[model samples]
Target: MPGMVGRVPTSAAAVPGARSAHGTASAILGHPWGGTALGPPDSWDPAVRAVVDLVLSSPVPMALAYGDQLVLLYNDGYAELIGDRHPAAIGRPAAEVFVDVWHLPGVGDVLERTYRQGESVLEKEAVLPVDRRDGHAAEQATFTRGHSPVRDSAGRVVGVLTVAAQTTQVTNHLESLSDFAAALAGTLTLDDVARVALRYALDAFDADRVAFAVDDPGGWRTVRRVRGELLDEADERLPPLWRRVSGDSTAPLAVTARSGVPIFTPDGQPMREHAVDRHDQKVRALASVPLRSAVVRGGLAVGYHQAHPWSAAERALLSASAELVGQATERARRFETQHGTAQLLQRSMLPEHLPDLPRLRIAARYDPGVDGNAAGGDFYDAFLLPTGGLGVVLGDVAGHDVQAAARMGQVRAALRALALADPRPDAVLTGLDRLVASLGAEAGTHELFVTVVFGVIDADRRSITLASAGHPAPLLRRSAPGQPRAEYLDLPTGAPLGLGCRPRTATMAFAPGDTLLLFSDGVVERRQQSLSVGLARLADVVAEATSGDPRALCAVATAAVAGATEDDVAVLAVEYAVRPSRSAAMEMPAEPTAPSRVRHWMTEQLTEWQVPETIVGAAVLCTSELTTNALLHAGTAARVEIDLSAERLLVSVSDSGTRGTVTRAQTDTLSSRGRGLGLIEQLSDAWGTDPTVRGSTVWFEILLPAG
Candidate 1:
């Protein structure tokens, strides 16, 4: 290939810096194509030399890629286009320098066509993301390239010449526009979308602060600030934050809202001398753009804490950010309005509060699904049935939005009405299914469906009857008094509501220390596992915990799958208490004088049990001190329970009405206030606070003198 170029270049053409002004490219031309298949520059063809001369003289970005491999050759303009891979890129393979372009969707095909077939190619406004560096710094740059063939003096096409310019700035703005539009679609509130836009604007313009505010009749109200220190304009010495603009501008926020113009307040302005401005004096540059929405009108402000030279591109980006804020604000307003109406509809259909059953503790919790602002169909209810039975139901209508929530309300109300008429569990669900089937037919709803489980707990009969309609099974956990074992009660299943099927009921008898848990599918259904797996996890958690408190049981079950569930959740549970035959409990009023009455009541109960005289006085003292503390701190000596056995005398004072913990206080000489918990510790052989499903009971056991 060295002699293939028969004629050699003249001495004037071979001079080092004669052909180009760029030092690196000119030096490489002296020993050009080093180690490459092409020969030295002096033995180069005349046509290649002429093209290289034109490239070096032109200011635009251009490259001469010779031979089939497209070995790289460039001018000063091309070196700047190559970013950090400039100097080493000379005389190297063109594929290595333009490697990122090869990764583009169809760019490699275009280049191969020009190289193999000698076809010219031209493009306009095409998106080609190219990495300007060989390193991991992915500066995503887009470009428009012009490609044509370079021929020898004999007119035979040999290589391709490529002309390209970077369009990263324009592509970046378009990308931000698309990203901001997508974020605004699923947002739940104005604050949600405002935060999203603020984050994008801050990163895009490299500004320190972003805000969306309104100049309402009262004062300036800030919706949010993404970053930087924000001042609270509540001081009497300061004017409103919206009015403290640069120079003599009055209410620049209002002016921007009226004129739809962006206002800038650069650093060292004249009228930034007010106390309001001093609070934020570190603010070096400020730009306010107007935001207009159908529901609200406001202004957006982007600020920098250090000196900044405002550019037209930055101003345009700020305006675009404000537009996103407005559109998102309007959507949030509509969603909030719909969400409020749906919430009211759902709450009105469900019970205001669960009934308080005697000897049975009950607790229920409901949480909307993870989808923002869209109501779900999950519903739960625990009401007193007509025949001294409790009607507990958990239902799920299949959808999300106002329609699903409304259907849930309707089904819940119908279940209540049916149960009140006939307290049978099967009858309640059968009637509900029939009612839903009829309603679905009337509404022409082909997809209308509801999964429900209705249960009746008869305390008088000590029996529970539950019937399901394609719903999650209820769990029944049983443990003996002072034992720590639990299980699940498997109930029969049938078709969901609106699916016509003959349904059957399941009944089981239970005693004290047994718990019944009814919940919606959202409680045990996770995206990653099967429903049965989730149910087994629930059983394991219930077995490991040793509390009969329904709230504690629900808390553990919900926490086990806290972030895993993706639907609305509801949990309802009831636990029967193990009442002791030898214990007597009395409810006492919460008053300053209630302690004396409780102490007398406890003394009489101990005397009736023939408690020894030596410990009866101490037991009475312990009861008096605990009762007095409960009344003083918790606002109530809610209940006092006294139990007597052959060896121990147990007395408990419950202050379940309030939520302050009983703590052991330090000893003080003058003030006798902080020593009650410590003294209670001293008087009893063993003492602990027992938290129940509803409240807590502080109990103490005293060892009776040897009887």
Candidate 2:
């Protein structure tokens, strides 16, 4: 009876002058608290009374559960949340009153931690099922709840206080905005931006249709997506087509893009007045936000098929999304412009084509770094020396910029000039070192240095003399019977070019069917790996190559690495092989008598080479047919080259035409245009056509009679 509130004498109250309570507070004061763990109101501890007073005085939804049984007490603000269970719920156990959702993760766990461990918990967007009080089923409510422990005079936690705020709509909007930002961050081009923006807008805005448009040089580029389709039919290109829109266009997207204004219309009348097509006419409402950027102007528009009133929150989200897209578009445009110019400058400094020397098959390749937006300093060159030997060089400057490209051009020109003046490998490198030092002195920066490997190939000696100036060792791949061998050349390594030092040259036997590979550090450098490991990998990959051809070797070396390189890569490969024992070339004009002239020229040359008369006749006939075809189909000047090896005769006719490789299927016996190819294929021992960078080459090989 002492714990019961109704049995407490009116004259024996704790707070004698305290004002009369109201609402849930009044209910708490008059309820029967007999069997509850909290006992009666008059017999309750001062700590419990203080916490109850605090919960009832707050304006926000708050509740307090006290003692071991966890009796529930709340204010008028919290009573609305419990529906019809409030008056009878007062002074009752929380687990009994809210049995449906008390065991949920954030609900009961948060209260238990605060009560038993004296820990505070803040739970966001928690779902709780509460009675509807309208005779309908219970509805789930979302709330952000905070739980704090209540302490007594002895510094021990006695109860748990809970304060909650409904945040369903706010949480949804924040999540949507965050997702939109994340999606836009990965876009790298205008097409990417448009695709991501249109797709996200359709789902986030819940609109029937979404359109993203940007101002282009000629007109406007737009991409649209409907709710159920991937993209509009007319805009299916990877980068959608650009449609010209005049300044006076009445389309909502165009107007906002041009004027940098946002337009929102809830009624269909305004949309009808400015409708540009059938799609616009079907839109009942629209919201257009302008993309605010210093470099490019654009706009985004969301359309609804049914009437929809745009809320302030929705409008703000649209504006923010547009801003993100605008910034990304600007960045992509800048990168494209810079990358194009950098590539052009880097390529213009390199050799257009390698020298075509006898007994020396040469091939070179250049690839930019992963960041293609900047110019790199890697370079390669090959030319015929005055001494009749081949001069080849591969080098890298210390930076990636316009200045580095200019320096690369300077070093390349100087090396060629020095090699021509004095064809010695060491002398060429020494001269280059002086030039590099002078360049660094002029630029007033010691950072201007270069690594280069200069080599001279002497065909008669069957040897290549190489000198290095702080560059990676050149690789030598030997072609054996069943096992090929690859090893790095061991030469005296000198200081880099800027710091002058005497370079020593080493000559190695470059026998027939052997290849020499010169590459930059980019070809053998990787993240988190030692340089020796990369070098070993390169050697292994090169040794396993199927052929010793220079072209195939270059391709295999670059592809040996698995991913994009951090630095530019340059590779130059030279293969020593059995070339023509005797050769001659003649150029004929694209005239009616060109084939006659070529036939007579070929007959005289083959006769001088002491080719058998029968062989000469067949060779002259095939040469005539190839020359005729080149003039008729190519309509350009043709080059006739004839090479006589120890056991075969090679004839090739090249023309500077755009016609690709001529296949056997194209050589119909009935057509006058292809009769020559058919005849050559039948008469020659072996014949084929190859597509060159500029045009095509049709050649045939005839085996000589045995001695």
Candidate 3:
């Protein structure tokens, strides 16, 4: 109507004026303004009574707003809709009490416009989103809101009245009708599908709790409870939800299972709605919905809270989630089972072939301690490089599980590939360092830094080049006759792979009869002393095991360790030939001779003794200078004597040249131009002048393997 309206017609009866006896429930209950009690129920008009009945009977929560305040309310269900803090909102400002709805675009403005202009406004499907106490998001609900102005007897607008009914439940129903068909696409595991469905149901449909239960021939069992209170305690209470007595059923699952469809229980009740709580209070609100799998016979129960009724939108959400969870759960379960088998397959791919090098007569023993409960990660491998160089590597992967072992295999393969490509000890390590830094260790683990000791042996040359990444040094045995003892070639502790790319290398020359043993720290680190002492002990044992064969030597050395080391141990050994007599002799040619003749003569002596090519060149050059000095200072007639000994080469040149007597000076000076003697002093093992009555004999010795 163009003018202010007094009453609106509907299936409901007409409402009375503001000052009349027909006031809202709050006003009738002695509210300060516009309060009046209706006549007894029997005395009231059937029409007005019917309207009252209709408002009370409706499941949707409702309230009446007169001007700025809530003046009427119906049952407890309607009062609780406003939440605990504001339940007794009657006579309070409608905007203040239900602030969430008052702030909606068309709600507050429409009410204000109706009061000012004496107009009436109608709104359909208004929605309010609210955050619940549990921090979950909830839709306050969809509602049909209307505002109408009330006029006095003189036809003057006095106040505006408002009507609202929450419609969230109805909306959910329609939405779910279409959503259910698309919820479970491509999901193959029951648990996966169930979790997805439960989440969507609780979030979209406003279900209090959700759960998944499987049929086990005889009964049902709850496999998972996505959301629900009392889940741990009330397990096995619901029959239809699960086929076997496995675990608890969530509120939503129990409700749906018993009702054979989604059930709404606004009051927290373990049984039917008609059941009353006579013993106690504090019952929470609850709802339960069932999800049936199209591909499987299992079902999931989705739950909701009791404090609020199910909104229409919420129903739609539950339907959609039901389908998705059913399918997803089945797929996840199957995939998880298959993963175990995959781990076994990976274990087989580890290195199965190890090289057996001679001179070294290498032996590799792999002990993956305590099988079954865990996967093995320790690894060792050796092979002959294309360069006739032998490569040996020993490493420990970061973990002791199957996944760790699998990853270890991959790392080992990469290392082997590098070994095959580079064949050089340094190159292989450089490649490994680069690879791990870039690729990274396995997931669910921190950065990996492996302790590896790698070596390259040139058997023909009797030499070895090795590199270490925080690994212990290899043991060496002096197989050269007198004392068969173990010695260690110490390598610096370079940072492990991916640790600042530090370079490391150490070289050792082995004689034919010497045995070189390379080992992990686990062998000796178990001693009472520190690592240094342990190394000494290893050297001590190797020295003692000189009489044994390669296998016997290994056994005896390993036994020398008092007890087992906590970590694994790896050892490799090589023996070389000894040249004892070659190092015994000495020779010196006469000086003052032509330089060519001196050189020629020095060369003859070195060739005669068959000194190693490395020291031969230097020895020949030094001999010529010493010989020429004796000839120039003491005259051409110099007596030369050569002493060939097992431990060194000693040579002397005696000349009758006298400059008083030349003493080996404590300090070097210009007058002491015997710089040639200084060269002899610096290069030879020992050099001195033996004073004689006529002249002095200057002699020096070059130490051989005796050192």
Candidate No. with top lDDT: 2
Question: Per-residue CA lDDT of candidate 1, range 453-494, in tens?
Answer: 888888878888888999888888776555556566667788
- Candidate 3: list runs displaced more than 4 Å: 1-107, 115-144, 148-161, 166-297, 302-318, 330-344, 351-707
C-alpha lDDT values of all predictions: 0.66, 0.76, 0.52
lDDT by residue (337-365, candidate 3, tens digit) is: 45334334433543343453334444333
Candidate 2 overall Cα lDDT vs. reference?
A: 0.76
After TM-score superposition, what is the CA distance of residue 497 in candidate 2 from its true location, in Å? Answer: 1.7
Error of 2 at 525 (Å): 2.8
TM-score of 2: 0.55
How many pairs of residues in model 2 come into backbone collision?
0
Candidate 1, residue 692: Cα displacement in angstroms equals: 23
Candidate 3 minimal-lDDT segment of 10 residues: 1-10
| Candidate 3 CA-lDDT value | 0.52
The residue pairs in collision within model 1 are: 476-489
Worst 10 residues of 1 by lDDT: 1-10
